[model samples]
Target chain A: MTSEFELIRNHFVRPTPQAILGPGDDCALIAPALGMQLAITTDMLIAGTHFLPDTDPCQLGWKTLAVNLSDLAAMGARPRWALLAGSLPEVSEPWIAAFTDGLFACASYYGVDIIGGDTTRGPLAFCLTAIGEVPIGMALRRDQALLDDDLWVSGQPGLAALGLAHLQGRTVLAEPLLKPCLAALQRPLARVELGLELRRRGLAHAAIDVSDGLLADLGHILQGSAVAAELFVAQLPPLPTTADPVLARQCQLAGGDDYELVFSAAPEKRAEITALADHLALPLWRCGLVVGAAPGQLTLLDDQGRVVPINEKGYDHFG
Target chain B: MTSEFELIRNHFVRPTPQAILGPGDDCALIAPALGMQLAITTDMLIAGTHFLPDTDPCQLGWKTLAVNLSDLAAMGARPRWALLAGSLPEVSEPWIAAFTDGLFACASYYGVDIIGGDTTRGPLAFCLTAIGEVPIGMALRRDQALLDDDLWVSGQPGLAALGLAHLQGRTVLAEPLLKPCLAALQRPLARVELGLELRRRGLAHAAIDVSDGLLADLGHILQGSAVAAELFVAQLPPLPTTADPVLARQCQLAGGDDYELVFSAAPEKRAEITALADHLALPLWRCGLVVGAAPGQLTLLDDQGRVVPINEKGYDHFG
Candidate 1:
């Protein structure tokens, strides 16, 4: 019988150049760069709850690391190492091989080392802890947003949600949009470069990754910074033209899993932000502005400056 | 409905003085001490696999962190920070409260700070990533043992298995031993102090924590170090005196879930090892010797110097 240890050694053990010690020992050893603080985050993905049981093992692996990397991006940290803890119902060599392939693909892309982790027999689930590094006291924080700061987002938001909707049969999309949306859902890129640039240039005052939709995740910043936000619905980036306007709006406002960074910056830094966007060749959308009104409150306005009613804020696992 | 976020904030969020940034952020921040390398490890515990579904939540929580801490102990590292990712089938305030309390209790004992993690709704499971620190190039490794090294084990090695056996109704234990045995199973200490001392004093050449039974875990060291071992079964530490001799032998040889440290040192260091053990007021059992025989080979010998027949090596999740 193949034991968990052999499975790990066969599939997950790889040469980790970044680590002083790697998978063979009890713990992997890493030496963070001088004058840098380690940034750490963990995320868990369950089979039925986080992904479809029939989902491709490769995509599942990619998404698991991608989501955790997104957290590092939000913190303006440089990805360094990760630990993956997974529970599998049974041993399937093919499944594990494909999963590790996809996982290492993303890790290689982001230049993050898979240092160490654990594997066991149980339900299908994955929990990844990503470690990164940032200059001391330079890591972005949710509670540092200043009132009157312009709220910005990287890349088009809500594409992953649309993909999920299509997969769930709640919506149907055609051609080019279908593939991109599905890719967004399956292999969303963490905005690591954008975050690093923002921090290195001292631009963003506060930031958060949009995992639980635009409004809900931004609300985290609002509550943390004790500020309110006013988002102009008309100014929001356009969704796929093929989607219905109402469904598009709902997806943009309340759907999760976008893995885009939403940040707040001083209005005076608009020129710098534009230059940074130009350098990265990624559109930086100015969607809203931080306000001093009721803390944690969010207001959405139409083109006519009238309030738009929102029934749901975002996805709630228990709700 | 109680959302995953609220559950985390209410139960898992706390003041983390050790971390530069704690929970409620995208990622927690920590600074390793100068000239130290960060040692990291992760472990996953799943319901019906790592623990019984009816197990106490508090004890489960303690064991979750304790097991991960044992990994750090084996590497002779000082525990620093941890990230916990968990999935729960349903929300239970009391259960979460008790679990976090027990987790924190163990963390406080080891001086580990809960930095950050994720919570989701799904089947009950937990994956914890623990970080520790050791001076550069000073970590104890399984591959460092040399031929003729004295193999030593800390504490009673089979008490946990005995406790589990009693709980499983495989054995009947008297009152005096029952509570302590159960405690050994449920709340086994990680032997962190001993590991630290061994590394600090430069006494041990190789070390590993006994999580998967002495023979199996020791086999890892032998294989990694490219050496063989001869274990004197009669010299093995005794379990509770009340345990049946045959059953105790089985537990000592093949049963798992003991968090004691097993290490190897040069034969000439025997006096220093004894002195250290005397200082700590803990028995250090010298039960085996590393040899230049076939790599990864292990032989068990009785008092009469005859080979002892072995059936099972250790617990194998898939086996």
Candidate 2:
């Protein structure tokens, strides 16, 4: 059996080219880029809570780190380094090997270095702390939204939720949709490039990642910026014809686990944003507009501009 | 009933004066001090493995962060911020309240900001990621021990192990030793100040914190620096006369959970180090000397210069 130290050395230790000192040290040493500020986020995943206990180790590893990178991406920061700490029930070298392969695969794709972390014996769980760099004073923030800014959401937001529903047998997704939906849920593609471009080109006034439902996450932005929003139900991306439209709309409005970026930009930048969408070959949906009504109030409007009633909010772990 | 967001905002959210942006955002923003490198470390504490599931919530909170800070102390870094991600079996308001109090107490005492984190539902566990700063090229390292340097240890090394032994009913502690031993086990003080002083004054060649037993942890330094050590058993801190000398000696030699720092310093710095002990008002014992021998070797010598044979190594989570 591999000892704890041997397990770490054999699996978790990797070349951290960007770190001044890496995994072997008591603490990894990283020099912040000149004139740049560090953005830090931490997320925890627990077995049975975050995923099924028997979920594939590889996908679990990818999703664990991907969720954290999504937060950094929302801040328009370049993902740089991460520290992973977790508790394992037992030592299974094959499971660990597969998990690390997926973890390193995500880290490699995102240009992040796995620097340092800790492992312990207990129920299965993982916590990841991701660090990224953004030019001083340029990172996007939820409180920076301006009244009348065009609210944009990158890519489809409900696919992950639908994928989860399919897995739970709540919905049977069409054969073609099943693959993409599961991919969205299991292997999220964080919008790092879009965030960077938006910040660099001065396109976004504020931003947030859509982890919770679109409405609930947008409520976070509205509450932070002290504004309201008028969302057009007609403008939301259409559900696939084969999927139940009501359930799909419910998932789009209030389902969680979508790692898409929801941002607000000046109305004048719509053309620039459209060009960016074409440039990145990703959809940028103009779904709403920031308004100046009661803070954190979301008004769903139809094509005829009539108010629509909706009840679903979002996921709260302790709710 | 308080939701997860409310629980966080009400308890975990503390003022982060040093942070550009504190909690409530997607990511917390911190500007690294100029000319300083960031030292980052992550540690996970599982209820059953690291502590009793029914242990005091307040102390558990303190130990979670303290262990991570101990890593920063080992690096001779000034702790700046921490991100705490954890899973709870259930939301017990009073338990969380007391836990946050202890957590914030340590963070406040250490001048660290609780920036951002995540909370999920699962078996109770915590992961703390601590970020500290050290002057460029000035952090203490394990691989810098010099031959003939004095090996010094801070504080009593085996009290925690004795405390564990007492708690497990393996040993009956005398009245006077009980409280102190329990405190040593439950509330360890990281030698942050001593580490800073050592690095700032260039007093130490290499350093590591004693989490594992003295011999086991010292072995890490030896292996890293490619040097050996000769420890005088008689010079080891004497066990109390009231306690079983054999068990006490065993605990002292091969016990774990001691957060005290063990360092190697040049022989010429003895006087300065003694002065430092006076300044800090802490015990600094000169226990041994780094030697030229087979790397990672530890030789124990008695008062009569005879070698002593010992079988106790250190605690390994998976061993």
Candidate 3:
């Protein structure tokens, strides 16, 4: 078991910048630029529930921060500061250090400060509350998508699901998908740049991070916007290599922990968006279109013009 | 065990006026008032580590918030919004509901919105990341106190320590300490009014909220300012009722969790400080005077000019 002091001294405690107070006291403090509203979100990754028991400590740490960044990305807010509370199964000094390295790599990648938090002995559970900054009223919401808008998702999908399959021994991942797949699971990138670009262009109708699979995540936009969506099976960004394309698409729609952005925008802005995509050099694949508010329906169209039966409903915390 | 949904919907799901995108979404969308710098802070409370197993749910919830409010208080910032993450031992409906009620009372008292967070199945743990608004460069810091300033503390000390002692069956509370003692533990109030008063009058040099025993917490102020203090034992506010005055002062020196403000002010501002204290209707007791560059030293003096031996330290998570 890792002693709480060793973990604190090694991983979580760091000298903060002049403007901020680091963890030690009852609270960590920060001063945000004036008049800007804060964007805040929290996520909990339990050892057995969110990750496998054998998941590497470094990857686990990275995912914890990455998932929080995905939430900030969804709101078109740049990462700023994060508070972490970790409940450990036992004390492991090396594990804490490795985890801290991975977590800080992502934090430094996005320029977020590690502010305040706590560590305690318990089941291996980690929770992060990320705070970000955006100009007041500029945050994107799921309900803002308009009908008939074209939907875009950054980067490819199903790689994380394939990674999980490989981890679980459900399938043998070939060399091509192996690196991409594992990276997808181990180090899912948050779409911070894409979100900011869309917000800067003032073009996106609505946006959400694809944390719980594309279909389920998009279901949030549909439910909130009071609209349905038409997802084209063939239009998804290409995966590495598919042993079965249908299963792969299903994974894209149902697999979890892919932190790509699924968002909607006006059809008229299509060319502008494409130009912006070229500028950013990240994928902006248009995978679907918004539909009228018929309520409680999401339909998928195949190349053969048949509606396929979907089996996976994505992951649920309790269900 | 409490299901995740039930735990979240009951304890955390506060209906926020600024929650354009509420829970169940990828990120929360909020609108902060324009022209105010956001003051952010994070505080964590761990089960067993911070609270006893049989602690009342309502008190746990209230103090969880009061502690964070104390941070905002220390910064001389106005509390506006909060993010909460709770890890639960199991789903207890009544416990959850009572906890929510207690938490909301604090939020309502301070006019803060509950924005976002995560709930997980683990040992009881909570992290609250709070945001406030203050004029840039106007917030207080530990290094701002001048060496020759007057040292002050609000409210009586050692009550919460007595309350906890009673709860743990280590001591018996008697008379006035019983009511204030229990209240100190159950509904620790943040000195929000005192904070505002200090800023309004421009009388306070530096300030901190007391959680760790005064000796240890004041040590922080001394370390940061590189100054020292000679604390007069007789000047400490009466402990309500004490069988032995010497022991009571000893408790005052090491007592913790009296969520009051300890501040420094120029000696010339004493009368104005008294006026502000009367205006707020909270007692303001000048307990000592800051000593110049006796650097890194804190001493206690009795009426007979004897130095009291101080040994007990504040509560520590690892210890």
Candidate 4:
């Protein structure tokens, strides 16, 4: 029902760098640096699957780009150009403009360009392919974390999950405390600058962005790095006023859509990595340590230091 | 239903140059020579919009790359890497396998790589964003086409349109004549090497692929070049066969999905262009003349020296 074109303009369209040929052409042209290669990633968001029908188009655009940029951030690539393919039920100029406007606002703020995209009639859905750059062999991957490495995460956890709870009619929970988490879900900042900085400084051994909830997403890193990780429950960052422990815990463990970076650093390089948070003005939290357990193993400890069984899995497109 | 991952592996996962990253990663990385910038383009195909339901997935894959390649061709770039995003209704593994097979075949044939892509559950749809390499200020564009220039096109026209007619239940379209057109439409070949060769030889003044009908797409070049053009009906490439004049004329003049290059060249360079085409094994046809018709005009001359009006414009995303 919201204006689509306006939504697009308010979020997606913008004048990017001179090297980029932004949207409205058959494809976008981007200029990569010498000795560097182009890094590309794509993800799709279906209306009912990715967001609620009542979700704001502006936020949807932001979230769409956020998720894609998160992928680039995971690889320690600097954001550049993006292509969007949006499926629509009908032609509504305003809605598209708003959506694109949000998209571009985020894109421009992140120094990214909306190169070329497709607009078609179908179920309301959108896909974005983000292209970026990194020096050859410099991209950080999830397979590099080593045992005894300290695992760190950027920003707080469970905010996005709390936001979902609020959307699902859980009024008994604190609203103001969950606002930041909701915003985290809605407008996650792709840590491109931070990611590249980490790689440049040789700070991160492995990196990934939390998308399918911390437990599930981090598992990819665990599996890739062929290591295990142990999380200290007491060390998890808590929202300012999320008084209900049960809600907060669920948000932390089971909620998805937190597009924040989780990376591992050598224990010796911990101080330098912590300085990254201050320099970049982003909150970096040390959440755990890589353990000698077999690959793909993950354990959560509570106050009594007993293991917590994880039964809930992250969102799966097919599941 | 087709297996989702298989669809990708068979259709999209192509054997790329060892210089580029494989498709198994978050992003595909490609390294180009220093000082050469990357040209990128993105296009989407909707089920009912770009292709028909019964349309062969293999041809769709080829045509998809062809159209996107045409964009890079127009820019005078060397095709390098492509990222794919497929949104499917059924996630059928077989269809995806066939589709990806076709996609990879085209990528490998064209010397491009399938770097990274995403698949999702939705209406059957696909989008591809491609990257190519071009030296600074060397890419051909519509604005450079000039007055009194010879307008040229590559390969035969009307075949794709004929093919489309066949697909649309035009049972009347018979003979060896109609088969080529169908093949042309279904398996449109991109003039990748031709474009690169032309750019290397500094041949074309302006260029664009005829995705929209010739009249409409050619108009873009004329308008951008700030000149008028006289399209000679006699100069059009011969129809596949001596079919019904009306159908052939309409198909050649207004039908789209032809991935051939149309460009303007100086009258003096005609022989050289032709020789180059011969060397590249691509058909080059001299179709019209670019001249000052009215400072800004596009004309189509019919038989018997009559000026014909082309009112039915080609495809428009929103128009």
* lDDT for position B209 in model 4: 82
Error of 4 at A87 (Å): 3.2
Best by DockQ: 2
Please write out the lDDT profile of model 1 over residues B148-181, one tens digit for every residue. Answer: 9999998887888888888889999887978877
Over A56-129, each residue of candidate 4 has an lDDT whose tens digit, in order, gives 87888888888898888888998877888787777766666667668877887788777767666667878788
Calculate DockQ per candidate and list them: 0.77, 0.81, 0.37, 0.46
- A best-first ranking of the candidates according to their lDDT comes to 1, 2, 3, 4
**lDDT of each structure?**
0.90, 0.89, 0.77, 0.77
**Which candidate should be chosen as best, given lDDT against the real structure?**
1
Give the poorly placed runs of model 2, Cα more than 4 Å off: A1-4, B1-4
> Could you list the CA RMSD of all candidates, in the order they appear?
1.4, 1.5, 3.6, 3.5
Q: Write the per-residue lDDT of candidate 2 for residues B141-217, one digit (tens) a residue.
A: 99999999999999888998899889989899988998888887887777899989999889999999988888888
Mind sharing the TM-score for model 3? 0.90
Task: State the lDDT of candidate 3 residue by residue for A141-241, as single tens digits.
Answer: 78788889998988887889888887888878788768888999998898888878888789798888988788888888888788888888778887556
Residue-level error in angstroms, candidate 2, position B304: 2.5
Q: Candidate 1 has which clashing residue pairs, if any?
A: none
Instruction: Order the candidate numbers by DockQ, best to worst.
Output: 2, 1, 4, 3
The DockQ value obtained for model 2 is 0.81
Instruction: State every prediction's TM-score relative to the real structure.
Output: 0.98, 0.98, 0.90, 0.91
Q: Report lDDT (Cα) of residue A318, candidate 1.
A: 75
